[model samples]
Target: MLLLTCPWCGPRDETEYHYGGQAHVAYPANPAELSDEEWAEYLFFRDNPKGPFAERWVHSTGCRRWFNVVRDTVTYEVLAVYGPHDPRPELAAGDPR
Candidate 1:
């Protein structure tokens, strides 16, 4: 099974957490003025990048807190984890750290 480290609870089984999809998605500034296609895109569209990506996850069974993780989509490798409000960690070019 996959293991995901919670920012507050440390390392734990992936089952104790809930996937919250892509992180850092900005909400529309004026939803009322948006067209149907624009609103739909804002609500449902997401980039499915092939390599490493940032995502949000919640530690439901543990601390019940949400955090961000930089992970590789293909290998399921977690490169970093930080609180939702914390700035995303920087990594060297070509490095996952």
Candidate 2:
């Protein structure tokens, strides 16, 4: 079982949250101006990193606010969780601070 540290709710089981995919992706200002290829990139393309990754998550059954989480894919360890406007720190292995 994965242990996730919610920015607002503290440590919780992974089952209490929902994965919202990769973070730091911004939507285009003018959707109508985007080419099909660009739109496809935004809608379908996703990065599946094997190591530390930054992702968006919702503490669905808890805080419910969308925040960022740095997690390890192999060990299922959460590194850090922060609000959308908060700056992220450099993640170190097994340090969920």
Top of the candidates by lDDT: 1
lDDT of each: 0.88, 0.83
**Candidate 2 stretches greater than 4 Å from native:** 92-97
**Local accuracy of candidate 2 as per-residue lDDT tens digits, 70-96:** 887877667777887667767656644
Q: Which portions of model 1 miss their true places by more than 4 Å?
A: 95-97
CA shift at 46, candidate 1, in angstroms? 0.6
TM-score of each: 0.90, 0.83
Shift in Å, residue 41, candidate 2: 0.3
lDDT of 1 by residue, 40-86 (tens): 88889998987778999999999999999998888888988988988
| Collision pairs in model 2 | none
Provide the lDDT at 83 for model 1. 87
Q: What's model 1's TM-score?
A: 0.90
Instruction: Give model 2's TM-score versus the native structure.
Output: 0.83
